[model samples]
Target: MEIGAYQDAQFGQERTQERSEGSAGSMADLFPKLVAMQRLCGSTAFAVLSVHAHTLLKPGKIECTTQSPGSQEFVSPFLKLNTEFLLSHLCSSPCPVIFMPENAQAMDSSPACIVRNQAVTETSLAFPVQLGTLGNGFVMFFDARAMLSNDLLIDLHRKSLTVMREKLRLAFGMTTGSENLNDREIECLQLVGNGMKSEAIGEQLNLSVHTVNAYLGSATTKLNAVNRIQAIAKAIRLGIIA
Candidate 1:
């Protein structure tokens, strides 16, 4: 079935392969940025994970993991960090958290908490970045030394946000200001993000289904997304909608 030129299977394996390739390329290009971030904070390694949001309330169950070259060994341990708990915290706040070996256990409710069974040797600093519907996840820098100073942490946050946005644009081919969505297009996308179908949206907006679809199609193209879902995701991430 198709909805506003979007095939239901657009999200199937074929699209998954395309997204994977895009993500791999994007990370390769952004690896330098990650390295710079590590150097800025005196960390040995870094990792970035994009969590696919299924809904506003549901915990992100799907993940795409990427890390610095030669950091393969760290991936296993990195995943051991209470991801479900960590992600929940990241989603709630945009701030980064510090995790150290000495305090990680006692600070269970702290910004960074490791699972009881997990053994982490290094201190880690993590912060969440919003990538809209494409994927939203956190970037973490790991160091064997002590935690960063307040000055360094502040600078890291500023730089990390810029890097994350660039990653999102590269991974998903999002172009800033390349196309503009008008009032109707933005309205349609906002409703869709809220889980309203075309029919319901049409009724609510007092427009015909075809008109609603037209608006969505235009919005999708403007956002450079492959389909309605992606368009909605991109729009939300771009702050074009709520």
Candidate 2:
């Protein structure tokens, strides 16, 4: 469902699309800035990923797969060191600017651990950027020596990300507005992400099971998600669902 001022509809669409059109070609222009941010944050490395809707809907899977990651360029030695863990962590969760094992460090938290044993850096921070209609993506920073504190990480997201958000969104080539969600759909998703089943959600929302599923399905399609679960995850990442 699209919403707009009746008179400004064309103008609004044109404006957002115009913004999207120029972003794709300028993605590479942000590399130098990212490198500078990494240095300022005292991190050893940094990287970015673009979440792709087409890749998310691959057959037989409700979630995006690492076999075909939706990440944008800005690779580094971390990819070669802890490939799958990094992708899974970055792509799956909302992970809004989290410091790895805050106030400390760890090892062997299974395959998805960022540090990945003693081989990589001691600390890592992830900033999950919300690009409005551009879909979701993240910027990660890793530290080799000192523990990257939470304050620093939050500063990066609050101050640094603000400057970088529009630039990164353009890089993703998001010209048009992203999928829209009515109050009903977003309400259903918030409950779903809270571990509610369809029946429970229906009762809570005072609607029939069929109606609840309809809203959910509509949201799923709009988000280009493979299923309700995927929809919920993406919704959380996009700040659509808390």
Candidate 3:
């Protein structure tokens, strides 16, 4: 199937309206059609990651789910292990997913491996989904036994990108550059990107550590990073902090 066709199938206006009006608390509710698409493609698991926040947050940094060879729990350690490694290794050049395969080693010891291995073996393929303003991330389907065909993988990847675009818009309240980041928050993040520790930044800026940390915290939320380190990474990427 054509990539554009797959995106239209997954996103289109109808699904967007549904999600906008519905609760996003449950991944089930957020991605019912995507789950169906994964099954249709014969994928064993469907996983999503926010590459930007991987290093800063505990595992399950985003959302991941699967169906086959038994259900897997979304454990915190599993979430942290996978996300931290992916963030550390995946670079922004050529988009983030370019680094995923080479960096699979980062996830080698994760409990999610039992399930992740199902799709990341030598024979399996991974695809980069351009989520636009949501930034770069991957949509992977594991078939340890090679049960899926290349054609299907291609189609699935295309559809996954469309699904992800909408999912990210909803998840992050993403807008164009018009979505302003507060000046204080941006200033704090700029200091952070300069490699200044909170105390050092506080002294340099003539602010208390507590106030500096508060600005960092607000920046973290605005950037959608789980903590200060990831916040710095994101700010740098968005050019909000130089």
lDDT of each: 0.63, 0.52, 0.49
How well does model 3 score by local distance difference test? 0.49
TM-score comparison, 2 vs 3, better candidate: 2
Q: What is the lDDT of residue 47 in candidate 3?
A: 56
Models 1 onward score TM values of 0.56, 0.40, 0.37
Error of 2 at 234 (Å): 16
> Candidate 2 on 78-160: residue-level lDDT in tens?
45554555446545543333334343544322112233345432455555554434444566666534434443433455433
Tens-digit per-residue lDDT, 1-242, candidate 1? 12212212221332333333433245577778678778877877788867765577875562537677666576556666566766676667555666656534443233233333336666777766664666467777866354455445545654565566556656556564323567788788889989999999999999999999999998888777799988776776653554
Clashes per candidate (backbone, < 3 Å): 0, 3, 4
Query: Largest lDDT belongs to which candidate?
Result: 1
**lDDT score for residue 232 of model 3:** 70
Per residue, candidate 3 scores C-alpha lDDT tens digits across 91-204 of 432212212233344322211111233323332323454433445565654432333443444445545555555455445554343135666777777777777898998898
Error of 2 at 122 (Å): 4.7
Overall local distance difference test of candidate 1: 0.63
Minimal lDDT window, size 10, model 3: 107-116
By lDDT, the candidates rank as 1, 2, 3
Model 1 stretches with alpha carbons more than 4 Å out:
1-27, 54-59, 62-64, 103-118, 144-147, 176-233, 237-242
